[model samples]
Target chain A: MNQTIIQEVRETTPLIHHLTNQVVMNFSANGLLSFGAAPVMAKAEEETAEMAANANGLLLNIGTLTSQELPAMINAGKTANERGIPVVLDPVGVAATPFRTNAVKRILSDVQPTIIKGNAGELAHLVEIPWETKGVESVGDGNADEIALKVAETYQSAAIVTGKTDVICIGSEVVHNHTGHPILGKITGAGCLLGSILTACLTTNKSIEQQALTAVQFYGLAAEYAAERPDVNGPGTFLSHFIDALAYDPAKLERE
Target chain B: MNQTIIQEVRETTPLIHHLTNQVVMNFSANGLLSFGAAPVMAKAEEETAEMAANANGLLLNIGTLTSQELPAMINAGKTANERGIPVVLDPVGVAATPFRTNAVKRILSDVQPTIIKGNAGELAHLVEIPWETKGVESVGDGNADEIALKVAETYQSAAIVTGKTDVICIGSEVVHNHTGHPILGKITGAGCLLGSILTACLTTNKSIEQQALTAVQFYGLAAEYAAERPDVNGPGTFLSHFIDALAYDPAKLERE
Candidate 1:
């Protein structure tokens, strides 16, 4: 199922509209491009609705949510929801501050996301449960896996908790655990890009189960390939190779 | 004066706060680095004011303005103003659409920019005068030089109009006319990057006059060098070469 979706991603090349933070904008766009998706970063309230309605899928990221961007996200997400386009929400830093939490709540109220991807702490908070969170990193007590399932059930959306390993769940079912490279955390935008790649998968396939598994597998595989490159000069070099790996032929993954 | 500013840019390497669009974030960040400046893209309202206050300059670009980004821009711009840090505004597509124009006006009224950079049509519309604009390109009744001067005077800020030749103005002076290659337009983010480079120059130098000249001269020289590379296959190659040229030794600009 994973390989099939990867093949579809290569073939269809969906256009993904991202309303993301300024810090990760470029990386997200390039990451999407590498995975055979055309990325459009449109944040204006006026045009965002139009762009979202036209896109194959929409990813709403509040990593750098500002006052104006909040409205644009709501407008774009609403339009995407109305148009029957899949919406992926990355409530970046939601557990870190009140502003972020409120913004996430507002987005949730406005758009029924197909998937909500975040660290363990953010997910726990969004689901109104007590969990540990440390500066955008997931380091918490309680059953993160169980909490993820609860959040997914509560929101009626798939939940993704990314850390050393990524866990995706819906309701009581633990979907997939994708072991990605440790180096992925060293680079910025890894999580944001994952959200984008998931959008690509959602556009091509109907099953959330298949999309979640394939996205994690393909992303982890790409990171593995990047780690294998000669002279892996930390995050900078890893960032370049990660993109290259994503753009690399899917046949290469099979051979590996 | 220009030489003094260039030396200071190399020496100080001031951090610039960018609350900009997503399309050119990488190019802007890399360009600032190449020109010996630290670029921090902070759009989250939670941290934008802090970033702006700490940084030496602020650049607010609406190239991909989302509703969420507007508040961050306002927060950062207000903080930058209070801290006496120079702020540069690039009103991309201001003349082309009402959404863009209203945003530009709001930013202008809120921030009181130190410099306003755009093409002829953008500048014309910014000053409330009608002018023809075609998808980021401008071809109108007025001369580029005159339009640049007029806009500078109207804004009471330095205005830069880049085209076949880059024309910069402080009021009506038309201070610099930097002849540059046309191929620069083929690549995206050239103008967005110019704003970043200018922010670096302004933060390093004492006066905006010398900073403007150095910014235009250095950017033009880099473009000229990139245009000469034999392997310039397309826009992608051009972008890579542009970065390479920016990081190249300042001695390379001797001929141009």
Candidate 2:
């Protein structure tokens, strides 16, 4: 599934529009660019709708949402919906703030997202359950796979809950056991890059299940490959190597 | 001057607050980070003042400014002025749009800029001249070095004009004919990175002259080094190798 999706993504190289937090915008753009996708980040209220419509995929992230950016997200999401472009919602820190949660809820209502990618706690909170959010990090109530399945079922969308192991779910069919490295957390924008990667996959892979599973597995695999290098000592070096690996890897989608 | 500034920059590693455009924010941040400085990009209206006051240097760039971001720039600039934090203005694309020109004018009027950096046309436009702006790319008039010096004296600030040859002016004293690479323009955000690098220099190099000269020279040297690699086929590879060189180079500020 990963290899198939990678081949398709390399061939298609979709343009993805991201309305995300300031912290991860460049990394997400660079990551997508590295993965051979074009990224246009037009967050201004005036041009977001136009940008979204022209893009093959839309990614909405509420990591650091302000009152000013909310309307633009809704407008972009609506344009994406009208155009039948896939929208991936990254509900970053959804459980952390009322503003973020409300924004996520509103965006979800407006966009009718193709996928919702979040951590265990963020997913739990989105489904209206109590969860622990540890400063943009997540502490799970139980196993991530079970929670991922429940969230996917509840939202009626493909759910990706990423941790040490990534879990991808489409209704009842859950793809579990993705291998990634702990060093990924040290690198900023890792999750956001995954969301962009997922966007790239969903744009090219016709099968929804294949798209979600492949993106999750391949993203983890890339992280694993990057972390294996001894010189990739810290997050910054790891990030550089990871993007370099993703950009040049001939077998990007093949699970080793 | 270059050696003194590089030594100071590495020793001080100041926190720089940047109210810059989206196109160069990541590169600027990473350049500052590589030079051992902390870069805080708080562009929202609510936090710009606080962030600016807390930082050691403030960098304002109008390259990719939307109508919404102009106020934040002004707010940050004003705060930096009040706190005596060195404010460096990169009037990018100032001659390209009426909005950008007006914004740069407003900021200059209210806040005293420590250093003003741009290509010849941008500097000329900031001083209200009939300078030719060939799209966002400006080669400047033949007397760009003279133009930069005159602008620096007029504004009572250090002026930096960069191109194939870079120029730095501090009052009556001027440094001209610094060398760099032609391929620097192939990669976006090179100018913006220069601004951030100067901010890094300001933290350590006490004199504005050393800061301006060292930053431009170091960046040029790195770009020249990157150009030496035949493997740098495009902007992506060039960007990666440029960064890697910055991280690895022992004498980034060595004088020719």
Candidate 3:
């Protein structure tokens, strides 16, 4: 797969502003830093517009959405839209509660995201596809490809549906990437970090579809390499190695 | 240091209710889980009282304190106090912004935290001690031992003052633990995890001072062991190995 995008991300070092969930903030920041991008998390409603205005990209994740931050997220997305920078929205666990479902709908109505990323169940909720979910964990699949296309077509934005076989779609075009590890399933912020790195990828001059595809491919590959290490016994060890792999050359990713 | 506390934690599997900052939620949850304690993060004011009432312990960390969650934190701490369960208050970066400082002050006014934990600078800020700090990272030393004692006396809660030499104090009694690695300084949430695991320690029948001391000692030892691993090169690798060390037997921590 094209690695130049990765090189471009490193050279550009885009600053992605995050108004994300409380669960994965630090991990996403470190992961973005490891992937050669800068991350700034500014969630206070007072400064969302200002921070988003200065950022190269904006990521809105509602993993642990609070009522207080919803307006801030809308403002941040609007600022990013006005600036013509990428706005990646990850509607984390939208099916878990009515609060989340309504909040995401409110966001979609107010802002135009460049890309919307989530697991099968989460993205499926956006398109009214029936899917099973427990809390924030999405294991049920609703035909990921169709969900991606529907989400993309519905929102007039690119869609990244992550699962066993990841699917990305934009404007009737679809890309399938099979490059991740199950170890990612064991960790907490794996998907959140993907949204973060994907935001970084979008900051590059590459086409939106290819940028999202590369971000997914690189994230999966990093997970594969990290999980394959001999010293990586389980999720605990795999998480750290995953961060390291984000910074490591794919060739040097596995020394085990 | 006694290792039986580790066994107690594993056997009991106490549920720790956290109303912590956004940045370290996932890491703290993973770290606490690795340490054999269950973590429940419920910050919404609507559920904080209920979650804390059911929890074995409650941890209130203002690392990224926002105005929206201050009331939730206060309610959670009050609930934990009423239930006679241990409440750990990690006033992270209290000196950074007036928002954090005022939020902590407000929480302290309404709720009686069982134990107050912070870096030297953060604790100092509570007691009006002058200590230089940049943002949330506290490198200035304002006599952590004294700050711990003063904070304990002022708040009627045990205080854990973390720095190069970790100090834990309660009711004029203090414990100094020197067992951690500098690598811990490289990673985020090291202190937050200590507050988490320490909250687990507090749930035991042991005295609060002893429980806090043991938590600091065990955490430092885990960092030392994780940092000493041959495969651990930088902060990225050290963090994963550190999580493993949290779960590993103290004896099996550093085989490499």
Best by TM-score: 3
**Candidate 2 positional error at B73, Å:** 1.2
Lowest lDDT sum, 10 consecutive residues, model 3 chain B, at: B247-256
1 against 3, candidate with superior lDDT: 3
DockQ of each model vs. true complex: 0.17, 0.06, 0.20
**Segments in model 2 whose C-alpha atoms lie over 4 Å from true places:** A1-17, A21-58, A62-68, A74-191, A198-220, A223-256, B1-15, B26-42, B54-56, B96-99, B128-133, B140-146, B233-237, B252-256
Taken in order, the candidates have interface RMSDs of: 5.2, 5.6, 3.5
Give candidate 3's whole-model lDDT: 0.84
TM-score between model 3 and native: 0.66
Identify the superior model by TM-score, candidate 2 or candidate 3. 3
Q: lDDT (0-100) at residue A98 of candidate 1?
A: 92
Q: Residues B151-241, candidate 2, lDDT per residue (tens digit)?
A: 8888899999887778888998888756577777887888888888887777663677767787777777777776666667777666656
Report chain B TM per candidate: 0.93, 0.92, 0.96
Clashing pairs in 1: A43-B66, A66-B68, A68-B67, A68-B68, A69-B67, A69-B68, A69-B69, A70-B68
**What CA root-mean-square deviation does each model show from the true structure?**
7.4, 6.9, 6.3
True contacts kept of 1: 0.27
Candidate 2's displacement at residue B2, Å, is 4.9
The DockQ value obtained for model 1 is 0.17
